[model samples]
Target: MAALIVAAGRGLRAGGDLPKQYRALAGRPVLAQALTPFLADAAIDHVMVVIGPGDNARYAHAVADLPTGKLLSPAQGGATRQDSVRLGLQALAATGFDGIVLVHDAARPFVTAALMRRTVDALQSEIAAIPALPVTDTIKRLGSDGRVAETPPRDTLVSVQTPQGFHFKALLAAHEAAVAAGLSGFTDDAALMEWAGHPVKTFPGDPANVKLTHPQDFDRSQGAPLHVRVATGYDVHAFGDGDHVWLGGTRIAHDRGVVAHSDGDVALHALTDALLGALTEGDIGTHFPPSDPQWKDAASAQFLAFAAERVRQRGGRIDFLDLTIVCEAPKIGPHREAIRAAIAAAAAIRIDQVAIKATTSERMGFTGRGEGLAALATATIRLPEPE
Candidate 1:
């Protein structure tokens, strides 16, 4: 069976120059996230997209990193959503497709493999099937006079979502028939099918399968991780015989350097570990072993950059990076802003997202004796919900 994602809509309401599907959700494009589960599902034989007229380049960029073994060339969509569905169906038919087609919305990036399976399983017995959630709030039908015309039974009211499953040939024929009869404005494929005398069955739908629309939707999505990860890391580097020390990617004049394989920015190292920890990845040494000569005397800035990239690669993002320095010889208060800016530059995040603070050990520990510097860091990150 094939899956067709409808992404033709130009969502100006989402408040960006790019189409909502091409806009970044975390670090990846919205369409890319929507396409991920379908691409990984074993049951989906082929996947297609119905795109807007000038969205070729955007769509191409969105799916560039994805394994497109099951993807078909996109079909240009029509003005209306109903028209776009018909075009996608017709395109599939032209390729001799007679199997079930699951029509999905690109805005609903959280569609899961299990939901797709549920829709397809229902299609085994029914020609038309859709995923729907029961409505909790009372729905009102407004009349022409601006009064509530009817109070629909809350139990019977359901909010529908896609990918809506259908028998490919049957839905395509229904579209042609609707056009031949000069039908217009059918809200969805199921509604069109109902007009053509086909009953549409409903199955349980996921509450998280949300359609992103308003600008606030994107704002709210910032905290939409299945897991809000807060990980902490601490690093202590003893002072060796050198003239300068690296702290938070900034070189500070010191009596001695750090005893480490790299330049040993303690703050950067601790922050890197925090980022990796939040991602459940191994520590800094686990990725860049000290035994590797290539990393010897390397800039710790690169280490932090690598960690940041790993988060993006996982379709996750760092929410905050907090660092604390424990030292006595060099006053951290004097270089706090510089440290924050340096860390932000290395991580490619705003300075506001990076927090740098400092404290001493009150002449108690090795830090108080000015033997070495220590850093403590906390990274907060968000990863998309698992499929």
Candidate 2:
């Protein structure tokens, strides 16, 4: 089955510089957290995300490391949530998807695989299935006047959550009918399905699946404590006969290059070692042996990616990476920003979290003699405390 994640809303209520879905949560974007489970689920065939116009850059940064084979290009969203969902359904129809579809909210990042399975399983015997949590608080109805009109039984009221499942064709047809009928205010996919005369069945919802709508919702002090670690790395390479040198994943025109089995990106290599050191996972050479013929001329970016993945596998995140290149021949100031961006992309972290600097050896060493280059790196990372 396919999954559509709605993330186009402005999310003003969250009160942040970016949309709530793009906001950081537990060191990762909320949308990224929400998309991981569906992407990892073997049952899901394809996943589509709908975003606001001009949000392509933000979306790209958010989903950089995710698997993309089953991820479709984002669909442009409309004015209202209802309209955005309709446009998503239309995009699916264009792709000729007629199987079950799960519509999810990007703000609710805590959704679990079990809940997703339950929703899809419920759809096996029902036309539409929505996950809902029975209300435990007293329910009241208010009148136009500032007075309570009536109090309803709390046991009869339920709060709805998402990844609402439905037959793609039926939901698409219902959305089209609503548009033709000039209807525009339905809040969720299940409501539209109900309006179209489809029976909406309720399945149990997880209480942990709370939607983030305010700044306070991002406070992690109420949750688990994170352990921080710092590690440093240093690498040196002698100048070879090549006309260009690779540093921090950026190739620079130089009078000479470094002698190494790989691309010899000194900056990235040091940073990778720093990350591996932080995890106590040994050095880059331990993972990618210099003797391996298959890794000959391999991009240093792959090594950095591998180290970053190890951090993620341990439920850790790179907080900051600082790298300094020491050389005298090729000027680094000209390519500093590009190098920073390249490293950030390779490490799958934000650009601001990465710092790149360059300095000369004062013409006192191998770098000053124009014979080689050296780089130093320090990485700070946070990981969940071992139980």
In terms of lDDT, which candidate is strongest?
A: 2
Q: Write the per-residue lDDT of candidate 1 for residues 217-330, one digit (tens) a residue.
A: 988876644567899999999999999988998888887888999898899999999999988889999999999999999988878877876775566767799999999878
The TM-score, computed over Cα atoms with residue i paired to residue i, of candidate 2 is 0.61
Runs with alpha carbons beyond 4 Å of true place in candidate 1: 224-387
Q: Which pairs clash inside model 2? A: none
Poorest lDDT segment (10 consecutive residues) of candidate 2: 217-226
Cα lDDT over the full model 2: 0.88
How many steric overlaps does candidate 2 have? 0
Which lDDT tens digits does candidate 2 get at residues 1-387?
Answer: 999999999999888899999988876889987887787565788899999999999999999866665899899999999999999989988898889999999999877767888999999999899999989889889999979999998888999999899989899899999999999999998999999999999999988788888777777422567699999999999999889999998989987878999998889899999999999999999999999998899999878877876786566778999999999868999999889877776775667788988999899888898889999999999887878
Span of 10 residues, lowest total lDDT, candidate 1:
343-352
Q: After superposition, how far is residue 233 of candidate 1 from its true place, in Å?
A: 22
Clashes of each: 0, 0
lDDT of each: 0.86, 0.88
- Clashing residue pairs, backbone N/CA/C < 3 A, model 1: none
